[model samples]
Target: MSLRTVAVLLADQAAVFEFGVLHEVFGIDRTAQGVPAFDLRVCAEHPERPVNLLNGLSLNVPHGLEGLLGADLVAVPATELREFSPALLTALRDAHDAGAIVLSVCSGAFLLGAAGLLDGRECSAHWMNTVDLAAAYPLARVNGDVLFVDEGDIITSAGTAAGIDACLHLVRRELGATVATTIARRMVVPPQRDGGQRQFVDMPIPECTGDSLRDVLQWMSEHLETEQSVASLARRASMSERTFARRFVAEAGTTPAKWLVLQRVGRARELLEGSNLGIDQVASRSGFGSAALLRHHFTRTVGVPPSDYRRSFSRALSA
Candidate 1:
């Protein structure tokens, strides 16, 4: 399989990060490092038109659907799912039918679904949107748990970093492991993450209906570093242990232990992104008790090590 050319499809309200993922993987020239350079083209429905992103930025795309001609791969980045032109959708299906491997990132799967390209195919999307994707495309098998699903010719990936994983996997599959590794090293991501790598599920704190439960939730958030069991919490809330457990789950939609862990991880993210605290200090402040435990939960919850997350998201410290 010769992988030489890539066409990235963009639409109005495109996701900048997802588009950046494809551009990072195929647009950059790495021939100096022995990795093959791809003939990457950015395609839109209207050539030389301003393609808007949700973040108020826009790209002056130079190519239209015609740009997909003769491409080895066509990548669809996340964009607004409503009201895509019939011509553009036809171009997408035609590209796939013409033997170009088609890949979608994040909500981009919806475009493929709308194009009738995802019918009866196993796919993935941002976990938050998996239900909608499955509902809209009842014939498509949507696996919300995985980072991406590779169906030989069609690849559907979850949001953001998972797009990187899928693109790197494609590089490894068609180009070679060495080339993928070279690209990954330059992107500072794992060369070959398991396509089944878990997507990060954002668990926001649920609102409590009752005053007591609301106060307890606030207290728990404020004292995340301290160890507080159901019994102690029940006493503080003036309720029986069983009643407290039931009430907690009813209010939070999760068990007390699980909610506490989520809160701790959230706090850890805040500390990692905002402060210059070391790992051990972060663990202590976030109630993980030790750095090892913090690392385990942080990696599992956030899809990256705390250190890596910090490197990418942390604010610069003043010298």
Candidate 2:
């Protein structure tokens, strides 16, 4: 396959950090591994003009909106100014219409929405802007709790670090997980995060006199293969089942049943990726009881069957 050209649109008062993320991922040459590296260029609506960044530093971009004509992908980083220039929006729309994949990092979704690229598309941005984005673009389905949303040609990510995840996702989709892992290793970031941004839930914590629930949680981890029940957990914590259920939800951010399922699925994933255990053995060890049960929840939660995930991760490790 031919090398892909990536054009990044730089706006006045653009976020410097978000732009740096694109450079860090796509600008670097990783040709030693025989993978095609992107040809990256910074384009502006006004060529040869100095634009001020969020950090008060000005950068001169020589390429005009015409640079986006030949790009295979166009990235618009988050801007300090909530609004985007009319020319830049038109350029982005032209790129999208010309068969280029359009991507946004954080508040860049606002620009895409202005260009009418986000209509009827599922997207994500920083959680703080979720309501406003949704209110502004009623046609766009805005999900703030995910790291990123991959809608084939148009993609959007939530917050700063998630931009890395979105970029790696593109790499994985285009070049496979092996190449993506290589880039992640060079960049010193995880190839994939465990859960979405929802896992970083913000909640008020009430001080507890004693952490009896913590003891039960530790015991549950140690004895995952053993049959677990709400009554058993309540007894272990020396509380009524009703009170234990409420306290467990408060402490864990999720219900006990949901938490147990997540833990079991996580264990199954570890065993599948790290060990050569068969499906049945993995199922039993992870407290799923049977392979069918494992397959049911694994497909529902992880979005892939156990065998396929193992094959992909295993190839990534060997690569």
Candidate 3:
């Protein structure tokens, strides 16, 4: 069935950021961008009841658990780790049994877990909570490192901003790239981020304050088409190879080689979504060397092959 209505469930002490992410993506009406409006509803366990928020504020949700019954997508934003009311759990399970796509952000996975919906499913949550989620829901396969995991029907995202990536992915998957890109453009965020990309970059070169590796990192991004190695990057940074490698990890939160592959994959995604380059050409431009190599890294990083990614996005634009 086509994705139309979206119901966001909020419980006690909901994290406003994750809830806002869902609202920003699914609740907004962006007809100007050729995106259809979603029937977005923020539901709580008690209709017209005030639900507390983390910031000491409260929200008066108008709908109750019944609101989830007909939703095409049911999103559970992060809430305090407490027992889910039986009504909410039943509604969630019923929504899943009825084939609605169920999604959770951060600790909201706990609600899905409580509903017994995450059993044996490959899921993810905030890194801080992954251990707890795993221990609590031993049957569920939990991965905390990636941005999000899309197991066809159920999608779970990591902390805060990763929710945006997962939501846009759902838009890109169900609606099309055009809608996702339009939403992302308005939001000033990337439409797609590889789900497998590490949650933390050692020093997070992009957010690095020190100037030590800044120049080298910028150069690498600008020249992804060229060969890059630790030795080459070290030379560019004017540091010894070992020093550069250590500093790179310290700042990037990942090894230089892994970081380089991620950069190439990111470039390939941009080319796939925005350009009409052939696989070989795209690979060459992104420094993947060959179509086979691109396919391997792209799939491993983005969770989909390049051709499939292009076709998915292209169809969105044409549609």
Candidate 4:
């Protein structure tokens, strides 16, 4: 069954970005992209009450808890970390019991945790909160590295932009890849990024020093179609191979080979979304060397093959 009705619960100190993420995904009209609009409603504890936001702004929510009664999906955006009232918790549980999908963005997982929906489920949240989430709910396995977790009816996402990925993933699963891709194109974001992709927070790269390899990085991006090796890169940066390797990790937050693969995948995604190039041509241009290699890495990284990606996202005019 497809999701049609969505209810986003509001609380005191709600985050504008996370709330906006939900609205951007399910609350807008996208008939131009061939995607159907959802019956979207925003709910708060008090109807017609002005709810305070984290940024000092306030929203006058028109719907109360009654708005959640028949929603096909119930979403909770990030809010201040605190326990919800018994009534709100019961509503969340009742919605899940009624077969509605339950979703949380960022620290909103804490609300689900409070509602006892996360017990014994593999879930996640923003990395900054994963430690506390795990400590509070030891039965729930909280993986901080992933962008989101989809445990059947319950889905949770990491901080900020990760909510977009999780929301689009649900759209793809329920609607179809065509709809998901079209919506993604309209939003001007990559159609999909696998949940397991790193949050890009493990290593912090400091601002460039005088000897930074900014020029070398730009050169590599431009020459991705050609071969790249540690020896060649070290020569271009005028450093020893060992020093280059060390500095590359210090500056880029990843090893050279891993960084190169990520860049290649990004380029391939652009070609798949915006160009009419065949699979082999895309592989050649993205520095994958062969279609088989591209398929292996792209599938591992994107959770889909190149042709399937193109079918989902290739523009109609280009196709």
Candidate 5:
């Protein structure tokens, strides 16, 4: 099979780390194990311009935006400038119009927004720039909490390392878990992280005591099938509901109810992927109460119906 082409757009004062991530994932040839490798090119707006990098080093890009036409995937690394050049935006718009996957790392989403690509799409950028991105592009649904957003043809990630997560996720969605896992193992990073997680959280260290909320969290995970509520858990922990809620959020980085729902949905996904159980049985085991409830939250969180996810994974396992 022919190789896929990926183009990385370079600009002045580029973010070196984000550029490195694009190079690491798509620039390198990883076809020794029959994995499809990308044909990578670093293109600039002007072929002979000296590009100033974050470090003292400079680079001269040989190809200009014309290279974007040959790319199956086009990446725009983060930049220090809040606004992008009008010419660069036009090139990106043309690439997207021709059916290429346009991706952004960190503040690169700002470029996509400036190019009018994010007008009706949900996108993510660095959490620190969330306010500015929102104010600048009121038409875009800019989510700050997630690591990334994969809108099929257009993907955007939050900060530096989140670029790795977004790329791995695209690999998984396009290839499969096996290929994504292999790539992640080679890169020495976690294979998967749900996109809904907070970009950063100040996890409080648990007090060294026999009575701690950490123990309660473990217990809750162990007994997910049972009815769990904030008041009931607080009573079992021997603390007032208000204090328990505060401590839970401080330690866990999310509300107790939201956390419980996430855990339940996670369990449901596992059962759906690994078992041939009916929807009702999967729902009961995952503590979703009923199949209707399972369908509602599963589609809301996972972005697909439970039946579809099950069928896709089941086919993969069989193959």
Candidate 6:
């Protein structure tokens, strides 16, 4: 993959972060850092137009869709969902047909869907919209678990940050590991990422039929460090184990074990983000027993390893 030129296809209401990530990855003069510079241009369906962005921002795109059609890579940033014009959609299809790699960030996959590029292909989007995306394109396989899906020429990523991963992945695929690593280092991000969108999903409070099990749930949360099991929890709830299991599923919208693991992971995350505690101490306090077990659960649930997660989200970073 001899990637050089990158055309960012834009529309009104484009998300700032998604659009900026594309620019940061490919538009910057990174040759100083030994990474090949990309001939990147911002393109719109209408040339030399001011497209209103989300959050009261606006961008003057300098090129027309022809810039996208002739590029080695055509990138679609997150844009408001709507029916794309026949000309714009045709340009997208034409770019792919002419052997250009197509990439989308966050909701940008919706535009690819509208262009009929996702038919029978694996597509990933922000978890909140995966269902709508699948419903919209009946033939597309919408997978919400992964951070991104690389269907050879067409790559789709989930949410804003995942766009970085997808872009780095494309860079590594075409240029090599050294170039991707240099870019990641310059951006102060990891060259390779792990896990999936599921880890970033917020665990919503279960809307229960009643508050009968509220006390028990509260107790479980308060004592996350303590060893617990269905038998012990059932005793605390004053219900038989069988009945407790049934009620937990009804009220929590998930099994008790899954809920417990997620809760413990949340506690571990708090410690990792705000405390100077060791990984072993964090694991013990979060009821994971040992460091290995903690890593297994945390990595599976949160995408990155605990230490990496700490570095990315530590209070120091935020400050």
Top of the candidates by lDDT: 1
Candidate 3 off by > 4 Å: 201-319
Q: Given candidate 3, what's the lDDT at residue 192?
A: 83
Model 4 lDDT per residue over 158-187, tens place: 999999999999999999999999988888
Lowest-sum lDDT 10-residue window in model 6? 194-203
Q: Could you arrange the candidates by TM-score from highest to lowest?
A: 6, 1, 4, 3, 2, 5
Per-model TM against the reference: 0.77, 0.65, 0.65, 0.66, 0.64, 0.89
Shift in Å, residue 261, candidate 6: 2.5
> After TM-score superposition, what is the CA distance of residue 133 in candidate 5 from its true location, in Å?
0.5
Model 2: what TM-score?
A: 0.65
Measured over all alpha carbons after superposition, the RMSD of each candidate to the real structure, in angstroms, is: 4.1, 6.4, 8.2, 6.4, 8.7, 2.5
Candidate lDDT values, in order:
0.89, 0.83, 0.87, 0.87, 0.83, 0.88
Better of 3 and 6 by lDDT: 6
In the range 233-262, model 6's lDDT, one tens digit per residue, is: 999999999999999999888878888898
lDDT value, residue 19 of candidate 2? 93
Clash tally for model 2: 0
Predicted candidate 5 versus true structure: per-residue lDDT over 1-319, tens digit per residue = 1227888998777899999999888877778965687878899988887788877768888789999996788898998777778899899999888878988999988888989989988999988888899999999999987889999899999999899999888878877888788888888887886666557532232332334687888888778799998899999889999999988887777888888888888888788888888999999999988999999988877666888777645643565
Model 2 Cα lDDT, one tens digit per residue, 217-244: 8787778798999998999899999999
Better of 3 and 5 by lDDT: 3
